[model samples]
Target: MPSEPNTYPGYRFPAEVIHHATWLYHLFRLSLRDIELILAERGVVVSHESIRRWCLRFGTDFAAKLRKRRPKPDDTWHMDEVYLKINGELFYLWRAVDQHGVVLDILVQERRNAAAAKRFFKCRLAGLKYEPRRIVTDGLRSYGVAQREVLPGVQHRTSRYLNNRAENSHRLTRRRERQMQRFKSPEQAQRFLSAHAMIYGHFRPRQHLITADQYRRSRNKAFRTWWQETCVPMLA
Candidate 1:
């Protein structure tokens, strides 16, 4: 593929360095200083602050490109919400994933009420551009209310056991939450989680469902897509 246009204009660092640093920060649960130390060992002198800036600036762009390349989500959707403590204030994080474990959308809201549920449904459905065949969730009454208003005709299933896919998706976020000592604000949590989901979704295929060779091919393809999405454009 031909190179893409310069995405980091006027920055002293090359796109490769910036991209690598950003990737490390998101793809792994590493702190900015950890990334700084890793880069320093490789003979590249850079400050943690600079790495933070690069991530804040370019991470969303990379994620948007990755999402643009994803196939439309499956017809069956799983939705769930988890609690988040931001500055000691409790918040709800609503998340939706397809049957294949692909994240459809996420929202950090102040309540887990019917309105919050409706808003999440509206946001996710608007982005997907198509109605799902079935919606699955736990025994949350808010989900029923939202489904009735937004997706009245779609099949709605409520079973905690069946909704494991969506619930399991929160594991990474929980780990990252602990690592970062919890988010300072809802906006920060939303931005970081939104980008994290896309980047994580791109790289994480269904490992248990595929053979070793298939897994390797899938990972390689994901890496190639990442390189094309983040790196190739710079050369243009």
Candidate 2:
């Protein structure tokens, strides 16, 4: 039952300020300067650099807590890879999502070959209690080759048309990429995205499938859960 202030010792700003700034940076296409401006508007003077540091320090911690709270991902995994232009170099971002559109894992790699696919498969499969019932992916020969090698028994359906669930998951990363003027490095992209996917998905509920009131309730619940996980420890 510890509050954020109690836990974050020696920090100048309160836990709320740090958490809010991190939230704004990830949940929107806003830049660090934009976040600083917003906080200043509320009479909370903090530099953009400070906000960035806060995100780098605390974003992953919050995201880990949120991920721990997620239900076990569905058995059907949709996998896809997209090329990301970073520092004039092309890197493929491999992402896997469940049928419910929950991001299961993400990896930034230099190649989109069978070896890269195998690496992603191992990373995503780690810690899961059960192998997926099926995996859906685009018509990539690499995926087929890796599947046969790493997941011989799991059913894999390879089709560009059937993998919308995973392909669409990349939109958020694309939006952030443009806003940030493309990622500076693979390590930076991986760190930010590892936290970004979890935190953003924690707040975003499937609104189109529910009524307005239901959506509102879900939204409220999401925020409440965020506050508990990021700003305070939840009691058992």
TM-scores vs. true structure, each candidate: 0.93, 0.93
lDDT of 2 by residue, 42-100 (tens): 99999999899999999989998888888888789999999999999999999999988
lDDT of 1 by residue, 1-236 (tens): 96444446878887888988989999898999999999999988999999989988888899999989998878999999999998888999999999978887999999999999999999887756679999999999999999999999999999999999999999989999999999999998998899989988888888888999999999988888988888644222
Q: Candidates' lDDT values, in order? A: 0.90, 0.89
Model 2: CA > 4 A from native: 1-7, 233-236
Best by TM-score: 1
Q: Give the range of the ten consecutive residues with the poorest summed lDDT in model 2.
A: 2-11
> Taking the candidates one at a time, how many backbone clashes does each contain?
3, 0
lDDT of 2 at 176: 90
Q: In model 1, where is the ten-residue run with the lowest total lDDT?
A: 227-236
**Candidate number with greatest lDDT:** 1
